[model samples]
Target: MRFTIGKLAKATDVLVTTIRYYESIGLLDEPDRSESGQRLYTEDAVERLAFIRHARDLGFPVETIRELIALQVDPGQDCERVDEIARHQLGEVQRRIAQLKSLETELKRMLSSCEAGKIASCSVLAALGHHEGCLHDEHGGQEVLAKPPSI
Candidate 1:
């Protein structure tokens, strides 16, 4: 079935702006325009949008998704490349999990030290003010800790 941009977005559960952005970024191809200039999409667009949504939900970057789309178009390509990308994403996820676990540990330590006094004596505030007071030495020393949102 054919769909307008709105229908496509609704069908794929992706926002219209995001779909337009994807098109601008070359992630989604520009669809044919209707008689009055409205964008028209087909079943293939639905499938492609679904793939893009799923990849994004899995935390795959746009460039990686583009590569995967390229691979999808070329059926004869070796699956090894796809596997490599997935493995890389897995490693990143594992690393983040480890980092979150460390953060959890540090938070617990900070909370445990709190004696329910004023903000001056609050362990959480003290830790925030003085990183050196943290029980975990590696708490804020990593480069990742300084970086903004990655995924």
Candidate 2:
């Protein structure tokens, strides 16, 4: 059955803009257009979009997802590269978890030191004011006081 872009988005539970982005990035194939110019998708598109969605949900980067898709074209290819990609992603997840745990510890320390006093005497504020008060020197190399881009 053919599906319009809206129907495809609804079936995949993905945003229409996201679908268009995937197409633009070569992650998803462009759909056929009717004489009146409506996009027409097929079951193949539905399945491919689902795969992409699942990969994205798992925090797979788009370039990595592209590599995975390229590997899919070879039916007789060995599965080593797929295994490596999954393992690398797992490592990244582990690293983020560790960073979060450190942040949690720091936040708890700051809160615990709070004496229910005024903002001037607040330990949390003190920590924010003085980065030396932080238990960790760095949070995954993130800035101690990051500056926002100029609007």
Candidate 3:
């Protein structure tokens, strides 16, 4: 079945602008237009958009997804290269998970120690005020107070 851009966006749960941008980027194919110039998409587009959205949700970058799609289109390639991509993505996810755990531990320590409701005695406030109290590294500690933590 064919669908309009709005229908495609609604179906995929992707923003209309994102869909257009993907088309513009060569990441997605440009759909045919109706007599009124409204974008018309086929069931194949629906499947492609679903694949793109799923890959994005998996935290795969657009560049990586583009490569994966290219790899998928080629018929003669072995499965080994696909395994390599999965491994690379897995390593990235694991690294991010580790970073998150560290942040979680630090946040738990900071939040648990601070008194929230009191006017003058907040553990968070104290930690923010004292440089040594911050768990960040030397340059990072300075950066966090001036600029918010990356997380």
Candidate 4:
């Protein structure tokens, strides 16, 4: 059965703007327009949107998802390609986990160093202002006081 954009969004639990953005980005196909200009979708769109949502939830980038969709369309493609993508994503996740763990350790050290004194004597503030004074030598003498952006 045909469904409008709103219905599709409701059924897929995705926002209407996200759906439109996906279409604009070539991740989702442009649906048929109704007589009054409403977009009409079908079961295929629902299934595709679900796949997209699942990939997104798994942290796959849009470009990677586009490659996966291309592979899905071609039954002859080797499964190795998909495996490679997943493996790369796994490596990235591992790297981020390592970074987060380091951050946690550094935060703990800073917090523990605090003696409940005024801000002038706060170890946390001191560490923040002077990265060289960090307890750990993980950065090999380089400053790493600021948190890195998420991957």
Highest lDDT against the true fold, candidate: 2
Those runs of model 4 whose alpha carbons end farther than 4 Å from true positions after fitting are 135-151
The lDDT per prediction is 0.84, 0.86, 0.78, 0.83
Better of 1 and 2 by lDDT: 2
Model 4 misses residue 33 by how many Å? Answer: 0.8
Candidate with maximal TM-score: 2
Tell me model 3's lDDT, rounded to 2 decimals. 0.78
> In terms of TM-score, how similar is model 2 to the real structure?
0.91
- Model 2 bad stretches (over 4 Å): 141-151
Query: Tens-digit lDDT track for model 3 on 1-151?
Result: 8899889988988888888888998888988998999999999888888998888777777888899889989778897887898899999777766666666677788898966678587778777678687575443222223432111
RMSD for all candidates, in order, please.
Answer: 3.2, 4.4, 5.0, 4.5
lDDT of 4 by residue, 89-144 (tens): 88976766676678788888889888999987888898988877875556421232
Q: Between 1 and 2, whose TM-score is larger?
A: 2
Residue-wise lDDT of candidate 1 within 4-120, one digit each (tens)? 999999899888989998899998899999899999998998999999999887778889999999999889878999999999999977877777778888888888888999977
Q: How many residue pairs of model 4 clash at the backbone?
A: 0
Off by over 4 Å in 1: 137-151
TM per candidate comes to 0.88, 0.91, 0.82, 0.85
